[model samples]
Target chain A: MNIELRLFARYREATGVDHERICSAAETISELREVLLARGDHWLVLADERLCCARNQTLCSLDSALCDGDEVALFPPMTGG
Target chain B: MATYITNEAIAAGQRLDALAPSHAAGAVVSFTGYVRDHNLGEAVSTLYLEHYPGMTERALAALEIDAYARWPLLAVDIIHRVGELTLGDVIVFVAVASAHRQAAFEAASYLMDQLKTHIPLWKRECHTASTTPVWLIPH
Candidate 1:
């Protein structure tokens, strides 16, 4: 499955890209993270466990499901006011 | 109460007055945030604000709805400006209208706190693009 990934905050800065497309062979977030990591190990290290996942702009649990073409946002814990 | 969140333009004084009407609203409490020239050790020239459009509205509306459920709030307005802003430029303003001062004060505080912690706005602190820090806001 292919998914749209949105990045924000330091993650956006680090990757120097706000959004990207990734192809995933597995169906879960754990699988998606692995695919994302393969592209940028630094993103993997920085992303670690602090990022929140959003599916279709709605906040999702770690165990939340995903589907092809979903708009997923990966972000650091929000630091804005 | 009504809510206002914009990335375009806003009039702070007018927004405050409008939220607090003549008769029903006995008190109005307003909270305003400005782009500061300095942060910690850095001399900031201007700040740029960015946000996730759909998510921002969803979070703000959920907050306002919850505030309405909790207080006897008559009206409330939350206006936030986006793009580039300079020192003393108002970035966010929250006004609450209620029959008494208590709810007005509390709701006003609540709006800012919620916006800070929950909204999906991001800010970039620029001493110049070369020396800037971009951050995401919670509310």
Candidate 2:
């Protein structure tokens, strides 16, 4: 399935890209993280347990399911007021 | 009724005036979050805010609705600024109107608390005087 990955804040800074298209067979966010982690060290930030994940704009756990065409956002803990 | 995410500067006074009592509203409470000069011993030259476009509005609207559900509020306004900002710049504005001061104050506080930890917004701080900019994850 092809999914849209959205990166924000530091993640975007480290990767130098805000969005990307990834083809993955993973079913859950955790598995998706593994697919991303296989890329390289720059992707290691997603390994941080403190990292937050959102599936389709709503906060979701790593175990949350992913579907084709889903929009997944990854970012650090929110610090906005 | 205006819950917004903009790159423009916010006028707190004007917003408050707009929410001023027209009938039975006896209290108005507001909170403005400003970009501070320093954080964790670093002198921040600028701050950048980012948000999930479609999701940000939905999350903020949900928060506002939640606040109204918890209190007898007559009105609520939330304005969050994105893009680049400098020290002391207004980052966000939250205002609540109620028939009593207690409800207005509590609702405003609740909105801010929820916004900080729950909203989709993220903050990045730059200290150009020294090292590279860093993203700050609030605990």
Candidate 3:
């Protein structure tokens, strides 16, 4: 399946890209993150427990299942007041 | 209920006046968050805010709905500014109106607490003496 990966804050700065389209066979959000982590050191930030995930723009857990064209966002915990 | 996410400056007085007037409303409470000059023991030069557009709006709307559900509120208004902001700039403004002071105060505090943890907004602080900016983790 293909995923629309959206990165923000530290994730965007580390990756040097805001969004990207990627093809992966990962079944869940966590699995997709694991796949990304395999890329290199820069992807290691995804391993942080503080990282937040959203499936299709709605907040979801890492265990959430993904579809063919899911929009997945990875960001740090919100700091807005 | 009203929410706004913009890059423009927030006019605190105008936003307070914009709240819908109600015959039952006897009290109004408001909170304004500003960009301070220092954080984490460092002198800050500027603060950059980022957010998920669609998700941010949805989150804010849901907050207003939750506030209304928890209190007998006559009106609620929230405005959050994005982009680069300098010291002393208003970053956010929230106002709640109710029939009593206690309800208005509690609801306003609830909205701010929920917003700090639940919203999809992020802040990056640029230090005065450092070339790199740091992303602040929320408590």
* DockQ of all predictions against the true structure, Cα-based: 0.51, 0.85, 0.87
In candidate 3, what are the lDDT values of residues A1-81, reduced to their tens digit? Answer: 999999999998897868999899999999999999999989888888988999987899999999999999999998998
- The number of clashing residue pairs in model 1 is 14
lDDT of 3 by residue, B36-119 (tens): 998978999999999998999998988899899999999999999999999999999999999899999999999999889888
lDDT of 1 by residue, B71-112 (tens): 998887877777778888898888888999998888888778
Error of 2 at A40 (Å): 1.2
Docking class of 3: high
Model 3 regions lying over 4 Å from their true place: none
Best by TM-score: 3
As a whole number from 0 to 100, the lDDT of residue B124 in candidate 2 is: 83
Which lDDT tens digits does candidate 2 get at residues B3-46?
Answer: 99999999988999998656889999999999988888888899
Chain A TM-score vs. truth, each candidate: 0.81, 0.94, 0.96
Q: Fnat per model, in the order given? A: 0.53, 0.86, 0.86
A59-80: candidate 2 lDDT, tens digit per residue: 9998999999999999888888
Steric overlap count per candidate: 14, 0, 0
| Candidate 2 segments whose C-alpha is farther than 4 A from its true place | none
Clashing pairs in 3: none
**Distance (Å) between predicted and true CA of A52, model 3?**
0.6
By descending TM-score, how would the candidates be arranged? Answer: 3, 2, 1
Number of residue pairs clashing in candidate 3, backbone atoms closer than 3 angstroms, sequence gap of 3 or more or interchain? 0
Q: List the candidates ranked by lDDT, beginning with the highest.
A: 3, 2, 1
